[model samples]
Target: MAEVAAITEREIELISRFVVLLKDEQDALKRADPSVLQEIGAEKIGLAEQLNTLEADRRLALGITDDQNTREAMAGWLAQHPEESTAAVNWEKLLELSREAKQLHELNAGLVAMHLQLASDALTILTRQSEQHHALYGSDGQAAPVSGSRIVDSA
Candidate 1:
């Protein structure tokens, strides 16, 4: 039962913000087309790698490197053995993906807003129909033969 050390105040705050952003992204993602989520998720993995780099540096600086965490140590080794490495970090690619991710996020928000509006309109219509049914059918479930265009909000 090894307990993880408490995060620093700054880390805690950053994590809180990250969690909020992720949740917002998820909510926005719900109303988005599958392609939107797919593109964003793909870009997010790259951003995640960038984040991992920072985390690795922080871990080493704190002398918390564990031998079992081989991959975590690989980044450090890569720095020392540049000639031996074949992979490279493309800042431009990262930047492009980040831009695409941001765009997808914006699109997701707009879609969610549209969906919410549609849901609200649908609910209002249902409510009105139910009220009309109550008036015509006298309580129990039944439809009323009435039709009209109703606006939920005046704006």
Candidate 2:
């Protein structure tokens, strides 16, 4: 029980850190800073892996198998050990933080998508303009106007 409580507390702390990182990521996305975003992405991945390990440890402490219903098992454990109110509160806070992190991740994805679309549109416009310009000019730096008129028809 004590181990479970301790693990829950650790999870809460880690999750709080994760939420802070998510906020940083959001700001980076807003600023469109590729280098900062890349760094934050790596850090987020590391924190996520650590959180997964902590979750497994917490489950093991509760004697809940992988196939078991984790939420139900946690609730049962909390019910049986009413003295661990701190753990229960921490668990709730962890859930809230997880939800917040997920939301931030989704928002960041949307921002990335928007940025990609804008780039694609700009590229398309530039390509079309280049093609139009090439159609009006030959490779020898001579104008090949499409109006079927030549400046030197016999030369």
| Ten contiguous residues with the weakest lDDT in model 2 | 146-155
lDDT of 2: 0.83
Q: Rate the local accuracy (lDDT) of all candidates.
A: 0.49, 0.83
Candidate 2 positional error at 20, Å: 1.2
Clashing residue pairs in candidate 2, if any?
none
List runs of model 2 lying over 4 Å from the truth. Answer: 133-155
lDDT of 2 by residue, 1-155 (tens): 77887887888888888888888877877887777877877887898898899989988889889999888999999999999988899888878888888898899889899989989999999898766643665568886645544554323
| Cα distance off (Å), candidate 1, residue 6 | 29
Best by TM-score: 2
Top candidate (lDDT): 2
TM-scores for every candidate against the unseen true structure: 0.35, 0.81
Q: Enumerate residue pairs that collide in model 1.
A: none
